[model samples]
Target: MTELMLKYFRKKQQEVQTEKIYDTQCPFCSMQCKMQLIEQSIVSRKQYKTVGIDNPTTHGRVCVKGLNAYQHAFHKERLKYPMLKVNGEFVRITWEQALEQIKDQFTRIQDEDGLNALAVYGSASITNEEAYLLGKFARVALKTKYIDYNGRLCMSAAASAASQTFGMDRGLTNSLAEIPYTRCIILAGTNIAECQPTIMPYFEKAKENGAFIIAIDPRETSTTKLADLHLKVKPGTDAALANGLLKVIIEENYMDEQFIQERANGFDEVAEYVRSIKLAEIEEITGVSINQIRKAAITFGKEETGMIFTARGVEQQTDGAAAVRNFLNILVATGKLGKLHCGFGAITGQGNGQGAREHGQKADQLPGYRLIENEAHRTQIANVWGIHPEDLPGKGVSAYEMMEKIDEREITGMFLMCSNPVVSNPNAHFVKNALKKLKFLVAVDLFISETAKLADLILPTSSYLEDAGTMTNVEGRVTLREASCPCPGEVKHDWQIIVEIARVMGKEKYFSFSSAEEIFNELRLASRGGIADYYGITYERLRKEGGILWPCPELDHKGTTRLFETSFAHPDGKAVMVVVPNKSVVPKEEVCSEYPLYLTTGRVMSHYLTGVQTRRSPALAARNIESYMEIHPTTARKYQIVDHSLVKIESRRGSIIVRSKYTEEIRPDTIFVPFHWADSQNVNNLVGEELDPVCRMPGFKLSAVKVKPVNDVNI
Candidate 1:
């Protein structure tokens, strides 16, 4: 078996060598790993090692995916040219013919149902220029209010929560370097080990310095292994834990009175409400011991410098927006804000996820991190576009909401760029039907992925290696570069294709630009003084000086490492302490015995999110070839499940058949599954469409499900 596996791996590697260098950023979970090419003859392949730049923020280190990026880039299954699906068959077609077909179909849709009948979807994996042009084409050309990206699934809740409290929805207050300087770090529902692997070293170093680490999660994760105190609260009970922690801090007089009185509002009401809830009640609601909660509170209240980090796990809950608001309350009560190493930070999932939103790809936002609905922000964008502020649409439906609207026929057409929602979206069944219901669906991708297969038109685009663009990392550092390889076949860059499509549709005025460099330059000029500062930044300077951190306002001004220190940008110049009462979204009311075990999904080291790009790669496939569940041995025994045994994971929403690997790493009532599976064993098939009220993000982390041995002979 080993020999056979090695032979197959070598054969795939040989085939990859013969292919052209497809330089593109890894489309996995947003590290946007950079790649360099030095391919020798196809027969005797030669490649360069992945290298990390001396980033001002990250120093010079990448995670496992970045190191193995070349594998995904040179995968054999990568779509080589444009292909048309006719009568349930994908046939290769010329770029001209495909473009012509798309133009005709799109024109027909507009002529039939007005521009509002068509919708355009962008992706976080796309370049800033591509994302910007996509929104522009949809709004300016198509004149459609339906436009958004998949980042809504990752950070929309957190963004809405932050804006409601702090009046800004930026990524984070400090970079990963701030971890080493923190005296107390509260990791609320963020598992950095499996998600943001590159930032873990700083967390480890902070522990060495005696920094207190607190983890608030339903299940103990790899990040929790290093926690000084782990509050294993019940699922969707984060607000309860946060409220309990706040009550303890206030009752024990651990809060900073002077800071609270000076830089905050609504404290009296917040304190009054928090004081009403005793520690005992908090313990009952959150399922965390009061003593542990008190210890975590004391750690935060007593520390001189404290930081709080949240991820999708915290924001994907039904009460996610409330959980985020309460987290800010803890920071405000402890006086952790306005400091070099203290404040609230969000561990965003995508590499260009932050940049994607900043560049105006979102339905609610415009370029320069400005709100599309805000008069001033609209005026800013209008000035850039030489149009009236009213030209842009108000905030459109978010991703999950959009999917629901698709079934309702509120949205008729969709133009997807560099995103695969068929497998990645929560409640895959609903997404599949929604795509099928669309009057027209145009897909732009590097391969004919699951989502691509659902499209009426597919536009083959250049990979990261064949395009020139800038990608911003999680730390808010922006890197600029050129493509390493030439474009394969007639595949064009995303920006070029978007421009051409708009031009062919008689909207050439909106896409009058020639290159991505010009678009980037104009965007940088527009982003001045915003949280994502680029006033002093230029493509010429970045290409020569490497990437720079945001808030680089002027050439003389040094890039800011810490933000909102002296005072806030809000009207009152004070942060609000929103007293989020201890509330549970999933009481016995939400889930029942029919769907018993709590199931959570995340990424594995061997594969990336959805696995469309990574699974095609031979190296990644060799690492993790099959889909399996990580079930606690205790639960496995109860269900009579053994290691590598075929099992059916059934939920009220749906069910999937996958192999099981019994282990004690997870809790008995909890089962862990990676979202990387995309074929027969795709775990998302069983995930429900429940969402957080404010952000409208689906609850991908928490779902009740049952597991049983696959007894059928077909298995």
Candidate 2:
């Protein structure tokens, strides 16, 4: 360890002398498993070991990602100080110099090209306090409408669908504890066994209790192995399969007439539209048997209580919003929701994906899921911040659209924090080019991520363990993140960085804050009357109750655990039944003689999104060193490719070379690649930039490509 490391750890040790263990939540996924970091001394270095804590979400279970999270704080590559790009080379700089440069550049951009030239991109991993402050800083200090976060890439499709159908956007309608009591579960798109391992116990328990599980995917995963039935649907055809299931439920007279007539609207139109599709046509489009579709529909419709859960597999496509709505159609038509242990939801991927979308981080949203275009909402938030409604900016484009127009001079400058778009964005090669077209770029992170490498200014920020705040999990539960460790060198909390920048920009009146707790108090005032109300929550209450769900409007009110038990959030007290058409599973770059295979991207068990922080951990990196393509044995044989053979995958967007792992788990006409690697192994290079019409989510799950043995091609 270096002198700086020793100084950092010694200070942290002194602060927590009376307490040997500090409780905190995992920084990886939405499970938010509770864990205790026990202090340890190794030679001259101070270390902490992660142990599971008894909590409602995980019941004292921890995943590999949670156990290895401590390794990130002391990694050799951790950024310790601020730096500036001088003549294409990064040079050490003071915080004063860095903030001054950012303020000057922001002022110059706004003066020269107008406020639309400035933008800020936040993260979903940070606390709700930080996310809220970042949004305020963007709208008030920088006065720019172009502000968004990485959650747009993860859960925007589901959010859009849920809001339009249910009058709100929450990932789950009930808690994870209720999974075991459900009679049936329709698991689609998400492989919870690998992506969120802690939640797998609930599914296992449900299966043991005789609950029928239907796993729908194009590949056989750990999740599929646990299912009673696996529907190998073709990529981009999820909406069609869902529509087919709805048709089967209607034809068999499984529709609950009372529920449809009293608790929902627009069912007759949806039924009429689904009746036009034949089961055989759906089988041809989705590559699933008609019998299998009928069996699954019967299981779902006949069950007294059931649930439907979806994830990125169906949420990252061109028809993602429609696919999600169609899945909900079955639940609404069969009277499956608004009952005990029955609902439909999307499994959120990020740590604070639910909270980030609920707050003002999204381009078209205000605090507490309020629309930015709504004059009343703008006035409410503006009043809390001591500003007029007219001072607030209007809605801007989504994350993908913002990046797409960068080269066209729509976005000239950006402030990026805690997000690495270079490794995570679709059509990464084009994103790289778009980033370069920006006149100025500032990145605030704990390490020099791939996206930070392109920044003109890099500001060192504290990690989750070194900061204290609250985070909302997938179930809409807000939990606490304890500041267990000390920030090294001159690193500062993200909220403090935004505050200092705003002060430097002559917005001190609005940005004044002594602590994160103070910011949370203000956030509660801003969210009092909105959909995701947080007025009743407090730091003391969270510590005493473990975690609290949203819509706790009064101080005496307990948090709501299950929503829509009797009535929906809509003024009419009913859910909307949308009639979605069965669209074809065709990519913009269709398969041809040159490119005959379908390519899809996903995550692996050992790493999180983009592998920015996980890649630094020796344990995680050792488990998977580089990206590999998974191909069916028959496809490999047809291409003259053997197991572990190097292959070059070419698409209309770009190409990448990766080692092929032959397996029978995947479909014969499609291949799978993990999108966690950067540089030469980046799978996003081969992904197209097509956006979903409703949510603007990039179609990352489908791209037409062809594979060739590396030996047959020259380097």
Candidate 3:
């Protein structure tokens, strides 16, 4: 046979001999794209191709990161076997020995100190069952109430405000899938283009439907490019812009007076308060024109139906809670409550941030989205736990505050599960130091992460592909199923690991669940008739429907796609219109000559919230390996730094050496940096712990820094 013919025949044979279908979701971000693995060759692992399924929530589109999901599963850094750090290096150890040692040390600590001295920190990536088990293990087994998740950094402020005003801290009232029905969509502080790319279609469709779209951000990003009006406001001036819009809404009489009088409260006070905020005065503070605020407000308030969405931008500031309240004021005054397409929504960052908060991992919240401090909520959760709610600690410090108090010996022991805070946490230098001061540190990770390197006992855990669990997306849709692959090496599922540790600590009674299904059933019962109101959903119903929205707590109830369609969740069935005044919370009052540039840091589309999983992917690394500082071309010229040249960014907190990418995408006096790189060069190292007063979220953005050319070409 001819050589070409022989080659063609061999290729055909290879395809036929390759492995069959393997099912998995894109591991990069929360918009989990279900993919099908197609065999390409005999020896090589199957490559994934996105299934042409009928699911249109994301419109059958995937981002650059989603297309490369296999990279994380097959990465060289994956924890293949259990290892124990002996002396200064990690050494391979059997699962039996590692578990035995962890049990011994943790038990000894529990006997020596008290339960409050030991804390267990879980993650938003894990399923609700895993989170509940971890918290139960900490409280019942180790007898500690200091259990929290990393969601505190992602959505605590918005959750706090929503709970206060709406009587429920559940997910967004309107699903992103329902965005098409709106006449106007206002996004504040969220860069949906770069993060949460799956929902980009919703914003695009809103634009296509002639819905007025406004983006309020300090930086002009990809999402801002498509906005009908882009307000490049100053840092911490979100409330100013929001109030300025509300001022225009009141002055112009664009609100639905009938709805306000019938279905809302505090409108008179909100109007009186908004009258005090002059549009012209706020323009000076927000760096936006008075006309722009009026234009956005007119379009939004006058629309038949509108939805206002805010993300970490408004929720991560010093007055993040007020910023959220400001948006609520606009909606309530405009009479946009209790409707299908009109309300306020928060776009959460983490995959399971909503679920984790809903189920009982937060310091101030209990199961069923109830408050731990509220007597009624506490009583509900206490009933489920078969203990007095008063017996539980009232509330603990937030994630950031907890780290701050670590050195005071307030937090003696820590069990970090499925999270790498040393790399992702703001002010890495401070967090690393705090972890060092802990008397006992345990980390459960799929890799030997930087955070795990500091652990006294590390638990090797299975990845999402090797376990069965559910993850709630940003839109409050719950995706269910288990992995199709065998559990790799000696790694165990997070729940199984928690169960083992709980048994070792003599808390075996609370960890009696045989599978995630059994635990999820109990969670459904706890949430019955509660704020999240998952009384209609059941494990059996979930399997039959493939997916189901919450409030489907029972067998016969239909799920709700839009919230507050007829009645508001607040008292008197009316939404409250808060009188939000222009507030500024930027703490760095003055910028010295040494640090003249204002720095703003965030995530990119190609990487996850943190680069713990994405950084290990060669394809992702090839896209953007080293960190690069984004500065205006004029600023780069002033410093005599060539494009792509190495530079050192220094702040009062710390310093990092990174390359400079001179671009017009940044503001003149501001610089933008991606907060994904994990190393000394990480941009987060330069961010201080000075945080949002209401939310306790560190100021990852809005910091002063100085950038200078680095002569060393290798840097």
- Report the poorest 10 consecutive residues by lDDT, candidate 1: 18-27
lDDT of 3 by residue, 1-715 (tens): 9999999998877665555566555554556555554435455544545452334346456777766666777677788777777886788888778778777777777677766778878788888788766665665577676777788878877887776567665566866666877898899998989888877887788789888889988778999998988888776678888888988988998988988888777889988887876778898878889888888999997888998888887887667777788888788777776687777778878877877778777776667777677898777766776766667666766776777667677778888898888777778888888999987787898777888999877777877667777766666767664577777677788898888877766667767878888888777777777777666776676667655666565678767667777767787887766666576454533357988888888788778766877887778878888888888999888888889988988888888888888778667778888888777678878877776666677666667888888883335
Better of 1 and 2 by TM-score: 2
**Candidate 2: where are CA atoms >4 Å away?**
1-20, 45-47, 584-589
Clashing pairs in 3: 534-553, 535-553, 535-554, 536-552, 536-553, 536-554, 537-552, 537-553
Provide TM-scores for the models. 0.93, 0.96, 0.94
Computed on alpha carbons, the lDDT of every model, listed in order, comes to: 0.77, 0.89, 0.76
lDDT of 3 at 102: 76
Candidate 1 TM-score versus the reference: 0.93
In candidate 2, the residue pairs with backbone N, CA or C atoms under 3 Å apart (3 or more residues apart, or in different chains) clash, namely none
* lDDT tens digits, residue span 312-399, model 2: 9999988898899999899999998878889877899999998888879999998988999999899999999999999999998888
Q: How far is candidate 2 from the true structure (C-alpha RMSD, Å)?
A: 4.5
Which residue ranges in model 1 land beyond 4 Å of their true spot?
Answer: 1-43, 529-531, 584-589, 712-715
Ranking the candidates on lDDT from highest down gives 2, 1, 3
Worst 10 residues of 2 by lDDT: 583-592
Residue 354 lDDT, candidate 3, scale 0-100 = 75
Per candidate, the number of residue pairs that clash is 6, 0, 8
Candidate 2 C-alpha error for residue 277, in Å:
1.0
Best by lDDT: 2
